[model samples]
Target: MDPIQGKAAGTAPVPLSVLDLVTVGEGRTATQAIRTGVEIAKLAERRGFHRYWVAEHHSMPGVASSSPAVLLAHLAAHTDRIRLGSGGVMLPNHAPLVIAEQFGTLEAMAPGRVDLGLGRAPGTDGATAAALRRSDRLHEGADEFPQQLAELIRFLDDSFPDGHRYARIHAVPGPVQGPAGRPPVWLLGSSGFSARLAGTLGLPFAFAHHFSAQNTIPALDLYRESFRPSAVLDAPYALIGVAALAADDEKEAHRQILSGALSMVRLRTGRPGLVPTPEEAAAHEFTAVERDFVDGWLSNIIAGTADEVRSGLDDLQKRTGADELMITANAHGGEARLRSYELIADAYGLPG
Candidate 1:
């Protein structure tokens, strides 16, 4: 594939990527949603997307990506070229060795096309996080994440010091099969804590700008200011994940993006449900407060016709100074989401 070059003026020529939540929309089953995710992986590869990442959201009725390793393994099988990864796995909810083994197995299978993005957040409600960890002591685990991260890296590198209790243990299929050895590691955050940590460790950082737009620039600043050179990086590399959607017509794009904003309202109110259709959003009566909240949420998203979305994304890249932009299109229907990517890819003239 050729280098990414946006067709619009003032657009930065940065790589574009995908972050799939594998949303289970209204009237669809988890199996159907997962199949759609597979199609997205293949489409992304064919469209020359820089990478394809599935998020690890559990116990949410609207999201189906509970097991990123399993989903990514399936995605790797269907797509040969695009990078596949988690966006990401919650480190506080699993043993370090387990994560290393899972992603290492991915590396062994996909060779150099794997990335391991790790995050401190649970990615779900406290109850689900407790269930996943088999412990109610969640705060302690979250606090110990830095140590856990170190342990995971040691396992991935097979570099534990001699006499350490786990020195003899190994994450099978690790010390990865590819010549690149271990997959590239990225620290994901929606806050300054992880931004500073990622910078301190000299690893690439990805900020969740889609939801936490307020913290995006501040966290990126902290990352760059705190950074120190290390083997993984000589300079700070930052990627911002943005919520974007595009359609053939302006009104259609507006409707689809509003559906996604409504879904967010549901999630925030502790009433998570399948992604509502555009028709549903249009017909349903929104209270003044809900309408205001939805409007505020919608402001962070870049949604419009293909040309508008392309220009918006370009301006975002330039303003944020992000090395790349990973778009997460959360429109209600799979077809809408698919078409959004298609239109955006064509608008950018991505080498497919």
Candidate 2:
């Protein structure tokens, strides 16, 4: 039997959820990028993973998931059992009602298998954030993300007003007398502020551990410490983002990681270029600062063979005790990237 089955393991086990980075790896079109994501989701479902979430990012040439809701809807249609959701929708980018309508529609279609993870950060550059919402409120950080979260819940609650409705502001295709209700609502964050907010509001928390490795432990501690029982969640649900890339050997795994490092380099430098092939990354000469950045970030990543990946996951689980592990593989080479997720699943004794 798996060492860590139903119970939380002292050293975390296999059988974790996979997060698709949707990096456009040597692919001719965006369709290829999303298709790879769907394929990965299908593989994850076959492996009995918990969820398959796609993230939202705008104007990142390497990432194709600018519209997480739409992509999630597509992924849901393709897979039968794996949970589908937004790793997060940057709440400040759009109106809450529109988000409600989109996710409510998704819940109507997928029912119990959808997830709505919301985030307050603007997922793009300052100029792009301005383009997304040109109003002074958005530009000046006037987004009431917490209040909007409540409104979204109200829209999803079929019995929000104790069945005797009040105003004409109900979400169509919402929690009506139907098959069931929407999926669980989770708040995503990399800081203590969002963690505390999620705790106070009684919502599940998913930390951006991949991007904010520095804050992972502290944020989770804050969330769990301040949690209060709510109708939706009696206890805190914590998911941590994990950067992983598994290959046939240690050397190859390190070589494969160049893709992710290159993408990160592009992002931190304000270039936001396309996801490079492993060969391309190998060809480029990284500056000392860029090399340092990649090495520093790589410390948080798990790159090795299947067994090595499993061991790394075990260490992470032991250290943080996350409720779920969300895997992200955006390394170089599209085919290799896809294969990396496969290796992770196999290491965990999952189907691929």
Candidate 3:
């Protein structure tokens, strides 16, 4: 089908990017998922997307990006120009020093192309969160996320407080020495706490509108209101992450996104599994309650033909005043997913 066209007439041209979960589709292996992620990153670069980020999710049958740092290294090696990083690394899951070192290594390898977006959530179920932390205490680590973020920044900047124990220990391959010293840090959030913190720290912020559509604007508002100028940013910089699935038409787009919609339903219903195909989703029997639940979950998604999706995105950008927009499109097959992005890129007039 021919791609639809649209122009953001009144607003400035905003950068487009991608956030991938490395989703494993029905009848697909994790290896295939990772490979497809690499393929998509390459395509995104060719299509002029500004950055490509992988999310961290543990113990999920559907997501292969349990280790975003490792996966980012692979993606960085495979693609030349597109910036690669974690959509975010869940800060509470590991030690601050460890994360600093891992991302520091990534910067050493790819240099100016690495970004570090941090999140406080566990990124998994309660049991898995506990296991990842190697402690039965689940909530404690999350509560310490702010402190962890500070320490991570200090490590990356080689500026730990003199009295701090870690002050003497340098995060090896420490801060890059040129124009882009440390990997740019971004705070990822779905709520107000993270928004305020990111703003207070003067870091770039990314709000997850895909799942937390209700909180998107509020969080961004809080971020901007609380923002303070720092070395990293003189003004508040924000990006909104949205679920955007594009196809030949509205019906085709809706059909293609059924896999993701059904996956969300299964996840919320305590039966989280691999992403089901459109056929599988179509075949599943939904009770009235289930139908309602699925509809509510997918209400945030912007799915349609290229022009329709572009219009939705333009409205979102105008409403939020976001500096950039990151799209996440999940489909049952790699080709369909790629096509969705291609159509959106074409509609947005992203440079090749």
Q: Output the worst ten-in-a-row residue range by lDDT, candidate 1.
A: 1-10
Q: Which regions of candidate 3 are displaced past 4 Å?
A: 1-12, 176-180
Output the lDDT of residue 202, model 2.
76
Worst 10 residues of 2 by lDDT: 1-10
* lDDT ranking, high to low: 1, 3, 2
Q: Which stretches of candidate 1 lie over 4 Å from their true place?
A: 1-12, 176-180
Question: Candidate 2: lDDT of 151?
Answer: 71
Candidate 2 lDDT over residue span 1-352, tens digit each: 2111222222336347777768886544688887878888887777667778888899988889999988988887898877788888888887777888898889888877788888888888888888888754564453488777777777767445644343457666775556566767889999997899888877888898888999999999999998998876778778888998888898998887887788889899888887877788888899999999989988989888988988998889779988778888767556777788777766665643
Clashing pairs in 2: 259-332
What's each prediction's TM-score?
0.95, 0.92, 0.94
lDDT of 1 by residue, 13-73 (tens): 7888899999998999999999999998899888888888988898899989999999999
Q: How many residue pairs clash in each candidate?
A: 0, 1, 0
User: What ranking of all candidate models by TM-score puts the best one first?
Assistant: 1, 3, 2
RMSD of model 3, in Å?
Answer: 4.4
